[model samples]
Target: MRRKKQIFLSLGIAIVLLAVTWWVDLWRNTEATIQVLAARCDIPAGSRIEADHLALISIPASLNRAGYLENQELAIGRWTTGFLAEGEFITTNRLHDRARGLSYPDAALGRRLITLKLEPAAANGFWLAAGNHIDLFLIPHSQDRESEMLILEQIRIMAVLDENTGHRLTDTHLATTTGRLICLDLNVEQAGLILGRLGSHDIRMAVVNENPTG
Candidate 1:
């Protein structure tokens, strides 16, 4: 009878110790965090990652996983394959290292990619580049002198192309380029609206704030 009592007591002690160890592990995981690279602003597709575009963010160590780039040097110079919102985690699947000729990203489900040729002034004197957000406005051609309407708000520019050669232009070469073009990532409905106004209405672009919240 004494042996049975000792066996039960021993089992109870073992179980209690196991539970305490597990609780300690869980608490440590909850408090431990590591820094990871994240987008500082809205990073549009096809844009090369720069030091200023990234910010270090702290996340729980337990949430860390493979394929997430933790070093800023690893991300710099890599081109983004898709739009990354501010504070979004940078991952290997969304970036490429090769500088091969500009390749348009496949439009995400429920989204559409559209390119439009614009006058240098319409493209903000060719100063705009990928990752910049713009507000699009249209002036109707009606004889009654209709007011300019704001067609789109906070649309992201995906890439800037040379109108004459149809090649992507970098920021350094934009000054020498005569005509400029811009590609936009938009929803199906917004794409249709812009496409329909291509010939009839006078369209213009206004660069908006880089940080939406700021």
Candidate 2:
């Protein structure tokens, strides 16, 4: 009888120990969380990180080691290297400097940023912004005999320069005028072709695509 009683005591202790362990695990899963910032909305690549786009989130500590940003201040004003979705954790590896905007052309290998001059009338009527693709048309000096032939197929506009100064213009107010310049992201040979013809040929722009690039 004593042996049976000892067996029951051991079984009871085992049950209690299992229950305690289960409870401890459940509590830890709920309580052990790491605080981090995540994208509150879809953030486009190359966009400067804004406070409204971020949200504070608490995720399990074990998963947080996967590389999540903890400080909100550190993320603001930094340009995103790629598109990040909502609820996605902002990692340290995907940010770039806004002041150093050189990475825009780095997306396309072997492409160099070059400035191209076009008459406001030939261009997109002073409405072009960055990421716009335009086909180049060459208008000869004599208008009587020849037609304007397409010189280039599709050249991506990297940026639009200010009307007076050479500063980069934002899409919000790409403020266009007659002499506004456009920065192109093209291959070395293509850049050379355009640069050589700028003074001689009457180059014009025909908008192919106006979508914003990330």
- Which number leads on TM-score? 2
The candidate that wins on lDDT is 1
lDDT of 1 by residue, 169-201 (tens): 677234554777788989888998888877778
RMSD list, candidates in order: 14.9, 10.7
Q: What is each predicted model's overall lDDT from 0 to 1?
A: 0.81, 0.77
* Cα TM-score of candidate 2: 0.48
lDDT of 2 by residue, 1-214 (tens): 9999999999999999999999999988777787899999998777899899999998878887768889989899898988899998888887776633435633486677877666667776767788778887766665565544438778888888775787777662343453678787878887777776665568888888544573
In candidate 2, which residue ranges exceed 4 Å CA deviation?
A: 1-21, 99-189, 192-214
C-alpha TM-score for every candidate: 0.46, 0.48
